[model samples]
Target: MPVIVLEASDFTSPLFLVRTLEILSSCITFSLVASLEDSELNNNPSNLHFDTFRIFCMFTWCFFFTLSLLMHILSVIQFHSLIPISWKNLTMTVAVLGALMCCAASVLFPWLIMDKTVSPRPVVAAVASCLTFLAYASESFVLCTQTHEQRGYMGSMPGLLKMFQMSGGCQMIPLVVEVIRELPSGVYMWQMWVTSVSYSVCVLMSLVTLVVIICDFAGRCLLPFDRFLAGFSLMGVLLYMVATVICFTKILQLRELGQQISHESTGLVIMETVVASITLLAYTVDLAFSIKLLCDRGHA
Candidate 1:
């Protein structure tokens, strides 16, 4: 029979505590939302839109909770050593992504269901979701405290900028989704295509690079990593610049032709424009840092 040894440190570490909190809060949030009666929902017919919000919150909480539990079990059993990827990197990636999803869900859920419903389930669920978000954010910060050398590429400033690039891109997604759901198809089709391409490419590239580094494959890359990052960041900058111009122009045109656009669609477009601008700034800085790294490596 195989021995089943437990790693006591897994239970004692601050990360362990954070993960425990994450698991508990996620469960609480999921339960509160799931427990809401159909009668409660029927109280406000307008709350039919809340089905999407409820589903989103439920999925986010369940996904994170399951991951947190699996991570904890793996740690306790010391199975992470057998995993292919860098365990630290995997943990950090989960923490960062979970924090972002939970934050977005927490913000959106309450706004969608709180005032619309008579029951207090959504309000409590929102609080639990916020706590879960905080736990994940704390986990990310804790993981980041390691020395740059120890944490590899993800600990570098440009690497962190890559995270911001991904985050800014992701923030635009909800706005785009809202716009698509609310507005008729083929309306602002060009603007939508351009914006989608810009953020999608940026997010995909950044995510791929992050995954490569996390998998410890950066050193084995065919192209020099620094040069590759420089090129990628430059591409992100150009894409975002074009997106910003097109989106802002559309916004301006809509404002001038005010009656042609609904307030809701206009608000979504404005949010997308702002997020695109911020993401562009992040990409610009990332490009600069990538260039600096390339030059520094060349000199060395």
Candidate 2:
């Protein structure tokens, strides 16, 4: 019998490993900040200063949503040759386009609803935003599930893929919170139901993504191919799930707080801190991953 051992040094690319670890750390930090901030907002709806925060969050959400749509379109156009003309690809293409439209509509609905000055316009925007989030999530899932051979050039850069995922997750937060804020007080039943359903769905999706990533890392049969891209894709899904859960929890808490607490004021401070923390953590992870990639390249 012969003794055998496996070590981190046995890995081909130390740089890649380092980068991956950095990315993982950064993601965890982002989730922590986001979760904490959301919890704070739920606990205290007053004492948060600055009306600008709301506007900033709204603008940021819309900007990312628009950018995501544009990016997806560009990806499709750039990889047009790789796109199969078969029924399945065509169907996916159509679905992707449709999802983009839904996302656009959701992002813009708030503004449009504001102009109506009528019954339930706010609620409408909220519902639209939720739909848009679902569409985005679906689009990502489709992309992740595509066979590696079909992925084409899109599989090249893990960073770019992860960026899109983070962007989607980041955008989801404010829109959801905004909708909840707009709803009337004593609106417990509907909010509770919607929040529970949304959180559960998000959790399930995250778990699926985690499983995919784990399999990829284990070098299991690559169905969708491109492990690098898959890793990033899964990261996005996980991040989105975490953010959604945090947001939903905050909403649930706020609901319980009732009229005694000034939600807007408290929410602003809490959200600002949370968003700021999440943003910083995300950027840090981004930096760490970039460094790791660079190191790998240097070794190569």
Which candidate has the top score in lDDT?
1
TM-score of 1: 0.87
Model 1 score (lDDT): 0.79
List residue ranges in candidate 2 displaced over 4 A: 1-121, 147-263
Q: Give the TM-score of candidate 2.
A: 0.34
Candidate 2, 160-195: lDDT as tens digits: 333333343433444445545544555444643554
Question: Against the unseen true structure, what C-alpha lDDT does each candidate score?
Answer: 0.79, 0.42
Q: Write the per-residue lDDT of candidate 1 for residues 176-286, one digit (tens) a residue.
A: 777666556677777778778787888899888888877888889899878888889999999999999988887887788677667866876787788789889989998
TM-score of each: 0.87, 0.34
lDDT at residue 184 of model 2 (Cα atoms):
52
Model 2 lDDT at residue 294 = 57
